[model samples]
Target: MIRTDDTRYALRPGVTCLTVPGGAVLLNPPHNEKLAGLTPAQSQALKTLNQGPATASALAAESDSVTTLLDRLAGAGWLEVTVRDGDRDLYTLRPFSTPPARPSTGDGPRTVLSKFTVIHRDPDGLVLEHPTSWCDFRVHDPRLLALAAGADPTELGLPESLSARIAADLRWGGFTADPAAEDLDFTTRSWSAPDLWFHRRSTLGSRTVTWDNFGPTAWAKDEFPQRPAHRPAYPGAPIALTAPDLGALRATDPALTAVLEDRRSCRSFDDARPITLTQLAELLYRSARTRSVETSPDGAELPSRPYPSGGGVHELELYPVVRTVEGLAAGMYHYDSFEHALRLVAPADSIAVQRLLRTTTATLANGAEPQLLLLISARAGRVMWSYKSVAYANILKHVGVLMQTLYLTATAMRLGVVAQGFSDTAAFTAATGADELEECNVGSMILGTPGDRPRTTD
Candidate 1:
């Protein structure tokens, strides 16, 4: 059995004890309101926590009055408890996001590690963390780490005392799974670990867990300088695109309802009557062109486009990989939305480019190949520069918005368009000579002349 006397307690990380005119106020901003009205003795006791963890017996010996306050704070999760053996700390239960509910008492079912639990190195040597967990366990002992890593006490041949201690720590951290809960719910059973983790972190579920650092925090500005308004212009002779007259098109364009109803994923294309360069230019202009560039209050350039993006961080860039078009050469060209032009990145017959097109053709599952394959990439740093955890999720959302915009626009122009659900980053990187981390493809779509009888796969 684990000894309670060996447990040492301290204030949770990020919690501060303030000296007020009365007793003292415990301030954990964004998590709790000021916990005011404490006696001088209680405040003094809480202050001693800053020095480090102390046992209840030790604290009680110093001042008997401090015991009640310590127990209250520990129960409320304002205090973190560490199990110690001499100088070595076995493990520490640190409250991170929410006020932790006390672990269940008494022996329960046979335990297995939760599938969602992850052990990663942070400032602390190795931390056992879960996205939906109210607290994280800072593991110091290898024995405990092994237990968290899915070692059974019997298999590890750990001493009974040490095994019991590790098991208690595991219970406190909720590292074990609840098979009953998992088996009972269909939705719970269906969720993969990564999807559940992503869903939990990207959206705010609880005020106690999630901080108010949402939207345009500019979290990375200090570490990395803000990226320029536009990516550096691609090398090669730029292809000047035709900017269609908005006034003329406004009077002649299809109605919104007609375009919406006509929108479908068209897999078949007419190679005989391929889309002309002028038509391609109009499509790009109408769907993805930068209307105007303006500076944010924080001095970052925000480009307004036909589609909406999170924090106006228009990170998405277009590269049209062409196979056949009446007026344009067969090549992969970067769409310069700001300048309304294209810069050739790769030849049409390049092995890498052809491989990417071939993959899409196979994915399309039709006899036809894409006449014009548009690869949509994201300058991830643009959004990451401003936002924190939600950067990638926001990028995916932007991709979806742009896809819909492309769909409607292509439908109006009576062109065949099909949004591909998957893309090959390696093929794209090889074709464009771009770093995957710096700028990688997030989405892809195929566009061409609508066949006499277009095959729809909506």
Candidate 2:
């Protein structure tokens, strides 16, 4: 059966099937992986499948060719049995568009979201990308995300037009029907894994850094990369900043050189003696406190921090989970750069807060607790708004700067410090009440009294 122009056919999302001379080629663009070429007979079967769904009985009645062709392609998820009303079923190919979230027949079947489906929301809009779709569906419909999070699309009460658009997006973008059937154990990690999943031309998915997707072919897009306008300073943190003085601003060769040499990774910490509040204040004032807040060309207020950033966007924000800071109770506090003070995020000793501290300790010190742990979160909006390809990476580099800054500062003050590369990222977001996609823990570090320190001569 051939589908008309208005009729939606199941074209495999992200995988492109080309009808070539001797055989048909099936290419999975998202992974840059290709299936074995199909012979002319097999290609005809795929072509028929792409055109429209057919039943084994119907195909068998037409000719044994259809059944034989389908039999070859049926293994390994290439085809699925879709049941209709009265329990009638059709043998369908891998991908078929139109209401990709569910079946076309009313009262036929309600579709569910795939566990692998990642929902990302930006100022631009919501983008839903499943593993199958090597690209993103830029959803303009506001109700879509809310709908996606809730029940099946059929029960959402979405307007006819919006519903139709969503169905089209699901069909075209490669979201699966009945996402619950698949064993998504792998996606549990890959779904929120730190990596760029969406790009033009090149394949998407995987936990590899975004840069890995970059290839000569990826650069051949129609439009060149335009540096986006810098995002405004992180909002809602205290506007007032504190500027504590570090006595004697000395930056000479040997003094600076010694401090630099002193910078070392300290795994052991003096848990008995907690860091004084004065030390925390001084550290913030010198290392991360905002020096100047100025308006950018886009009129967005940008902050200048102690460390350098790619676009001066200062996308990094510090959240210190205090285990034992003098005069400060145990809790998670957002370091208000402008105010130069700690803004209470979660009450002291909250379960979420303790879990984060404990988790960080596990990640950084083999379950040993520290006096202070700084969770470095990136305001991705600020970076992605100003830059393209290198946005997430710049945040990572900024984390490096923050790490070095903390390392040297800790050394100068005779405090122990170390940076940890891993964390329960999803848990971090939950504890901090941060949006998983927008604000994330890019890196983490610990600060406390030096457990092992010795005098050194240069």
Candidate 3:
């Protein structure tokens, strides 16, 4: 949850709402407006009721005469009886607390200590206890604590006695642990390129025990592939296209032109009609498979195509999530652009395809069963071999360019196209079998027949 200076609460993306104290309840009139006249006694009663539900007799003890004030506040539209328990009138505060303040920190901080677990393990086996949730220890920093309390830890730093006292207070206050040795076993493992360490501890009877220093080891060196063993093997048969296809695609219909001109990012799709295999084949051929090859004067090979890729590396590969395409079984298939055919990776009904597509925002906006989805992945080292830090950006640019081509082509072919930016990168890489390579997800585009025309801001 990100907090703002104004004390407004934001729990997650697109979810912003007012937060009140635990016991306090919010009350607002049918229409929002200021309460015209609220007496001091009435206001005090409301504040007291905010602590918890209370009867007039209970409220009267906390504040002034509850009956007179409660009646006045209710008449003034400042308070409402939220619930009735026995004879007590539970009044809710009329206006909610102000929006939370903007958070001073953005993106917050990375976890310093992670996956902390207490385990009782003997040579025989191990039993895991409650896993410690990652907590920010920076709050225990003397400097920060002092600042929070409107004092200066720095000034006290020179005085050893005062500093020790403050440290003691902080330790006992649950902000930090008391200075002691903790007994722990450190285990490290490699996840992706980074090595992760897990700290294990066991309590023996009641005696306090501690281990020496325990922390993550220096990051292990990344072992990247020297070269990619796999190469695109061109198909023996020529990718076929017909004259009627070109004519039908070239026809100028506003909707069709919008599809062509609209490029990628079609949020609304028509699910009534099934996308034909011919249309799917056309899209796959244009975006995934190579259209033509060119040779330089020196005899170096080049691709003649609709997209501009860095160094003509053609690092991008397509994985299709086939949901409701005619003549195609539902499954997760890797488009063998070289073979010009779909290689079944997992059954369409298999959870693997659902899991992979679930990682994408497209699945949320459009239903999980879109007509077709194109998962674009890149061979990292393939592009990185020619480009360095810029490789990441270059590969993404290549995806964008290719998506534009795909969108335009889909539009011309009277199909819906949506480019999705939000996806679970790690999941995508794993599903596409590109996680091992420096390979990463470039982007994803969902296509189907156009449904309802989307409402446009422009």
Q: How large is the C-alpha RMSD of every model relative to the true structure?
A: 3.2, 11.7, 22.6
After superposition, the stretches of candidate 1 with alpha carbons farther than 4 Å from their true spots are 1-6, 19-24, 30-43, 50-58, 61-68, 97-109, 153-159, 178-185, 207-214, 365-367, 452-457
Model 3 TM-score relative to the real fold: 0.45
Which candidate, 1 or 2, has the higher lDDT? 1
Q: Is 1 or 3 the stronger prediction by lDDT?
A: 1
TM-score of each: 0.87, 0.50, 0.45
For residue 265, what is the lDDT in candidate 3?
Answer: 57
Of the two candidates 2 and 3, the one with more favorable lDDT, higher being better, is: 2
The model with the greatest lDDT is 1
Instruction: Summarize candidate 2's per-residue lDDT along 27-115 as a digit string, tens digits.
Output: 55333323355455555656666666554453432355544555444322244333222232211223322223323434434455555
Which 10 residues in a row give candidate 1 its minimum summed lDDT? 206-215
lDDT accuracy of residue 328 in candidate 1: 92
Per-residue CA lDDT of model 1 for 248-349, tens digit only, reads 989999999988887888877788999999999999999999999999776778899999988787999999998898899998999999999999999888
- List lDDT for all candidates, in order: 0.79, 0.59, 0.48
TM value for model 2: 0.50
How much RMSD separates candidate 3 from the native structure?
22.6
